[model samples]
Target: MGPKVIAFFLPRPPNYPMPFVDVGDDILLDILALCDVYTVIAVSAIDKRLHALTQTKQLWLSLIQDSTFRHVLELRPPNNLELQLHSTRELVDLIKRAVIGPPPWWPGGPSSSRTPSYTIAFNTGLEIIHDYRLLPGARYMALRGASAVGKDLVMYEVWTGRCVWGIAKRTLTRFAIDVVPGGTTARVLLALPTAYVGGGYHLYVEEVDFITGTSSEVFRLGFATRLKSLIAIVGEFLLYSLPSSDAEEKQVLVNWRKSTYVVLNYGTETNSSAILIPGYIVASHPDTSPPYQQLFTVTELDAFAPHWQPLTTISLSGQLFPSTIPITTQERLEYKGRPLGEFMRTHVRLSITPSAVYRGASTVMVYVNEFPKPRPTPTLTAQMGAFFRGRRQPEESARAALLTYWLKPPGQACGLRLVSAQLATPSFNTSPLTPPRAVLEHSGSSFTVSYYQ
Candidate 1:
């Protein structure tokens, strides 16, 4: 007898619309795989069957592999492919959160008034004379100050407020401090300014051993014979703003690890700041015939004008130190001259001027301080004497606001996104009101930590 063949087709009712639920899981997954993360999330919420199919590990892993995806999931990827499947839901949740802003309890939201996970009061005898720097994970804080005798550097656990290590008062004065981000090891860079004329600053790099409660100086270098202010440390480069001479402003980059330096002159004197973006230090040359020649980005800020200028890339293989490239146009924000106080009165605003800026892997965070204009209060005027009457006094409290932006391409304006705005009460004992310092965390969140009288 001849071999018999059987054919099976999915059942369909006449004059009835095709039921999406009847679709096969494999077919559904294939379709969902082509959708972007946001689309996938939206479709998954439509029905239980589609949601289950979208939750498969294969779908999320494929989405992550797509080069077009800009957002990232905060969770770690598993080593085992099967185990990775289990993280599909977590990856989806993180992606959703990133697309939407932070949760209410996160630092950027209004509900952040909830007490911090940890708090520490300054010791009875220790007074913080200088600002402090927090490590990447917020696990440790590095504080530098001048005591009764001399300057000291102290490292403390953020949660427990225990002193992990201390470099007591020494003859050397600490100019500035920076903490390098790492997991197991803690490294700090201390700048010691020179007091002698024509003498440059000293750079001290130290590694702290928490177990032994001791710190060892690993590297030291005399940065220059000429006095310069250490502005910032980005990656392995130390940025120094040169003293203005003959009304000309300039900057220099010292790669202390590699023992090389570069001088960049702005031609005209303008208040400026510079920051180096890690990993992007090297890039392909645009005009090279080989199409693979490398270059580096040098981002400089025109502080007076409040604009960012990304100068042309310098050849990494070039011999000229601090190679000067063609001057690029400026990327200016619209809220340049607008005062933040205008927005603080309502306790809410869409966009405001940024007083300080910090860059992350793919975003830029800006800080704003707004002191509210005072208004006459009926009760206070009647209670006080005639000397205090008839005068409108400014509010003693100010608002500390943080705004975030997605780092746009060169020559593009950064779109501002409001994050957190909080009211801060000034300390009566302090002569001048000091704005709270904002710190950005690796987990895409930020917080303002301040000390009052």
Candidate 2:
């Protein structure tokens, strides 16, 4: 009559209180092996069972064999391989710190300090300096100066205060310099003047070894006008811009290794700027993929424009790592001025120049300048009027300030938070001779920062 219906029973999913811990050690080790160094370290802290499991030599050996950990080991190179092999835990911890970076610090907290560790004064008698760069790895500082006879380039060690390299004054007027990222084998990209041809000046990119101080010509480009600026150099790509009759200028990207070039032209009215941080090339454009991504370029737009408000992220996108974390911008403006009615009264010019974004760390040191405009320029006419009225010449408004932001992890709802803000003092003011600026050089463990007063 009725079809024989066999009651099929389904195996219920295991709801064990500690299902993960109940897994066999081999299975657990396999799962932990797939986790990142940070995750393994965090799991190890949870309980004694997992701690013992994570501390096994087998697990650490697996991490040491990972591609990323191996790369860091190669770059920083351990002192002794035997010691590393003997102490896999120590090696894993070291690599973990290198990848995960320093611990997060609270904004406006006790850890934030504006004082410079130390200051170095430049020789005053030198010619007017046009541009300067702090080499990655924080071992060297390079300065390019303009003189009547020729331009002078000098390099110095930050710790020893020694002039490691120097270019005896030469007649190259236009110059720009950039340091290759990572390793002791830092290559300096120097743009030097060559022979005049085709009714314009010829320029060549010279690859200089920072260690040996040997240089060779890479390639040459002919420019009708002067090379305005060397925006950045990432991998083989060198991005620079030139002065043009039209305000809309095209930024040229040249691959020194491949001997090829591409021109990126932003529409008129977009005052674009770009910089190469540790991992990515950040640019200013309205069409940026994620709205939360940081905008490095300075823009002039109405209050309604999306670019009007400062973003809460220190966004970064590159070959290996691509992610965005929210940043705290309000705390940074605490000393500058109030945010509410102040915006309507005076135009606030905000510029974000990131010096270094350390790999494996959430900390970013950037120079932020939020000042009201029109930045009063002291003109002869104004000076005469002030003199006639017996009033002190309007004190030049302090426009440049240095800020450091600490990026928080996801799901915390905390974005980029300002940890420190210090106004550029009068001693740090820019002049015809020494410009008020700071350059970040990567030291092995920390940064050797140089500020020009």
Candidate 3:
């Protein structure tokens, strides 16, 4: 037979159809290395072996380099495959980098960087919104706010999940918090009798008195009233003292100030002044600074009763202290005296502007949002590909049937699908054999990914 005829009739490679000579294994591996994750993910989805192969550093690095899937690896974080990567030392080193910075949470602990805890705020106004069934007995709920909220009313709601309190105070109240009757000014407290669960949490409130115009007397409600929500201790309020319509001139205070607060300890007590709560610290009113500057308050309000893992929610609000003042720098220093840092352990000076919106009786608006920005993703470098291939020249035949079946014809480009194949059977290019395929079982240190025909 002539050379052309001899080549045409010679049994074509085992995995190839008659029209094409086999392509090279090097090209096959290169194609896979070049494939973006969308394609790899789909291809891997087609076969178990392919799926395992997708986890390889080279393949992974390939997918990451593809602009489309890079964020998935970085954003989703620490995949299970990473555990199997056998690069535990590298992982540990990355976690170690986190320990050096002040964490997103308070009073720093070791190694919290890798697995940061979230600090989501629980809001007031009617009603506990969720059941939060995922929480265990050990994790507790904390109600954080400035005083005069019918915290007691809120406590009632916290315990019963019932809407029993009334709304007498508007959105703004002053004095920092409510105190026990005549006990003290600004002394907000929740006297719950239940055995505490999961250690406990703190509660702040607004306090007002009937002394009148002495400090802040212009604002006075004729009737004594109180508002509440969270179905219980989780809502807001308005407390008013009533004046006899036909008889007497009632005495009252114009400006209200913070007196006391309620909080608890888990090994140690967390300082619950305006500072510790991230939003409050940044948004405090100017005149309301100093008292907060000092040892804010010494109260441990643990409400966990033993064995009581009750399905609960609480509502809260402040007394809408009659005074109004703009948030100011001098006021910040008044409460945070000296440098803000030195007194942090002693005072709640860290304040941020509140981002939530509420219609209020006070002239000013409060905003409570301060969400953290999402972290940026890391990109895979081409050098990583070279490092990956170094491990495996790595293997046997590229003629496996499914790979052969799904293999394309050259127009396919960068996308979720495989780019086309050069009809030349993959194994043929590098092989000296009349047909193509590597006889060896393993490749190199990188391991093999053989799929059944």
lDDT leader = 2
lDDT of 3 by residue, 210-272 (tens): 122012222222222221211111112212122223222111111112222211111111222
Candidate ordering by TM-score (highest first): 1, 2, 3
lDDT digits (tens) for residues 1-453 of candidate 1: 999999989667787776776777898888877776657778879988777777788888777544233212211222345436557767666445434433433444453433334455543344545545665334566666624223377766665567777776443454444444333356566665566655655676676776577778766674433435665555555565666765444565556565555555533342223444432221111111222111222243221122212223222243122234332322222233333423212221121111111223244433334445576565754557545676544456654544344443334454223333333333322322222222322211222332110
Model 2, range 318-432, lDDT digits (tens) per residue? 1111112111122313345532112212212233332221223244444433334465668999889988999985544535554455543322344456677666543332321
Which of the two candidates, 2 or 3, achieves a greater TM-score against the reference?
2
Ten-residue region with minimum lDDT total, candidate 1: 348-357
**Worst lDDT 10-window in candidate 3:** 354-363
For residue 137, model 1's alpha carbon misses the true position, in angstroms, by 3.7
Better lDDT candidate (2, 3) = 2
- Model 2 residue 113 CA deviation (Å) reads 7.4
Which residue pairs in candidate 1 have backbone atoms (N, alpha carbon, C) closer than 3 angstroms, thus clashing? 374-394
Model 2's TM-score against the true structure: 0.44
Candidate 3: what lDDT? Answer: 0.25
